[model samples]
Target: MSSPSREAILASASRLFGDRGYRSVTVRDIASDAGVSAALVMKLFGSKEKLFAAAQPDERLLGELNVPREEIGAALAFRVLMRREREMQEPWAMLPFTVQDSPDPEATRAEAREKYLGHIAALIGDTTPNRRHAAVVVSLMIGFGEAVRTLGLFDDWDFDEVVAHYGALVQAQIDACPVA
Candidate 1:
């Protein structure tokens, strides 16, 4: 098992990176937040760049995609907007900041696009040859994520109402996709 200090460093880095962006955050800042020395952080993760890469949001969000095709929209909406229990410093919440400050923002963005459009597309079970519907749904979810995470939109609506409405819209896109 990993040592507790390592976990603390990782958690601290995740929150700091998300809050301050990669360029804005220093190794010393991470170490201070984690209650360790900067040298220790470097020893554990090697460098700031590697630490940032490791801190990117995990694939667990895709777990929501395990739902039935018809429910994919709601599942995605709930995952993106309402589900905030992961951690106080959830990496996903800082995605926008990381994308802006990462050393290779384009590459990071591309990786995310591939995961959301490719992996998620497959998980949605779009058996048809064309993936336009899946792509649209993925794009919509990205937008909703940005809105909720960065813009603070739609925070007032009843939870169920938002889920139902947003899910219905996304489901419309899925319904448009051709079946195998």
Candidate 2:
């Protein structure tokens, strides 16, 4: 059989990592899951770390939102909830470890954190007043994603319910803040 293309490999890897944590999976496992040879996996992605980075959905999420300043909060919450639901359908919840055992894990995590903060800042529109609150809101969203995955909440709950819950909470925060 012809070797699977790099795109195919990356797609498989993304699903696998999103379903199963990156640490628990092996290249051979990914190859078997993708119906390709281990050699092909190695050739396509230099290492597991590189493969994880390549498979990450961060860029995709950003692209989906276009980083619109006004609608960023709702857009981010919607996208995050959608991603969580999608990931929950898989056999495992592939939550990327912000902190890896790499030499520069702190730097990597800091960059990721900053990316998230920037998105929130665009949404809230007041760096001084909303920066910390936005971070809290994002963190809460991440926690909610994990909880939904862990409890299989999406199996019974609908998207509207999820959106309503998050929307109300976010709006409450915005309303509480003094208008500048």
Candidate 3:
């Protein structure tokens, strides 16, 4: 049989982590599922912690932020709102605890959080002025998304409606800020 490539191993790991929760899954589980040796998994990713980080979908959040500088707030809010909806519909939405339980959990979360804040800071042209406010806005969006998912509101509400509503609120907050 042909050996699985590193990409294939990572792909299996991503799905497994997304489906089973990171802590619940093991190297053997990923290895067996990927049709690769556990040693290969370790060799490629260093350790399970590293593997989980590598497999996280945080990049999807970053990817969605590739918008015009002038529209960063609206763009970021829209992207996060959209991601929240997508995550809710996917099995992985129920598995954030997996990422939260990582060895460097704070660092992992900070990295993801920074991605959002950095975009806003760049758009506003000042990391110091209203940075806390920007952080709060992003936090609200994330918290609301989690709440919606936890409450299973997506079953009745369309994802786009959620994004648009939240996006408009975020835009209003941005507009309310004193001209920088």
Candidate 4:
């Protein structure tokens, strides 16, 4: 069984990491935010790297994209919107931070590419490796998330209408993926 302090520490870690990326935030910061001690955080998570790894789960949300190709774009759109509503943020929003703000830019970029974007590209493609098209779809998702959640651009827009319109835009890119 987990104690409330442990859960609070974890929640603080996730929020700090999500906001400041990997390198900038530290155990002390997370501890302060969680109202715990640095020693406790170190004892619990071992290290900042371990804390980061634990903070970001395998992004099961991406699994929803594994639908039929024809419905993939819509699925991506709907899933991202759902995630924004539920999680207040998406992995794509952290891409730039995970790379540019990290100590090891190349490794971070490659890992994120493989873990998040690569999975997205593979799901969006049949057999041809549709990386370019997937990039645009991810870009759309990131932009939509930023606009709707951060800037409140589409507050009054009907949910279904936003889904259909953005889903169509994402679908156009999915349809452009060429088969090998």
For model 2, the stretches where C-alpha displacement exceeds 4 angstroms are 1-4, 63-74, 84-96, 100-103, 177-180
In candidate 3, what residue range of length 10 has the lowest lDDT sum? 87-96
- TM-score of candidate 3 relative to the true fold: 0.65
> Which tens-of-lDDT digit does each residue in 1-180 have in candidate 4?
488888888788777776777777888999999999999988888888777767763477667545678887677767667766677446656556657766668887788777766776778663544467777777787777667655768778887788898889888988888854
Across 92-125, the per-residue lDDT of candidate 3 in tens digits comes to: 2433554476677777567655676776555544
Minimum summed lDDT over a 10-residue window in model 4 is located at 122-131
Looking at candidate 4, what is the lDDT of residue 54? 70
TM-score of candidate 2 on Cα atoms, chains taken together:
0.75
Report the Cα RMSD per candidate. 2.7, 4.3, 4.7, 2.6
Clashes of each: 0, 2, 0, 0
- Candidate 1 global TM-score: 0.82
Tens-place lDDT per residue, model 1, 1-180, is 489998888888887787678988999999999999999999989999998887777767566456778887787777765455344443345656766787898997777666667765676656655567777887677677666666768777787787889889888888787665
C-alpha RMSD in Å of predicted model 3 compared with the true structure: 4.7
State every prediction's TM-score relative to the real structure: 0.82, 0.75, 0.65, 0.82
Q: Give the TM-score of candidate 4.
A: 0.82
Residue 20 in model 2: lDDT: 60
lDDT (Cα, tens digit) per residue for candidate 2, span 1-180: 334477677778777666566777788888888788889889878887888777666454554446444344465557657766565222112333534532357887787677766765555654664476767766666665556665656557677776676666665655454444
Q: Rank candidates by TM-score, best first.
A: 1, 4, 2, 3
Q: Rate the local accuracy (lDDT) of all candidates.
A: 0.75, 0.62, 0.63, 0.73
* Best prediction by lDDT: 1
User: What is the total number of backbone clashes in candidate 2?
Assistant: 2
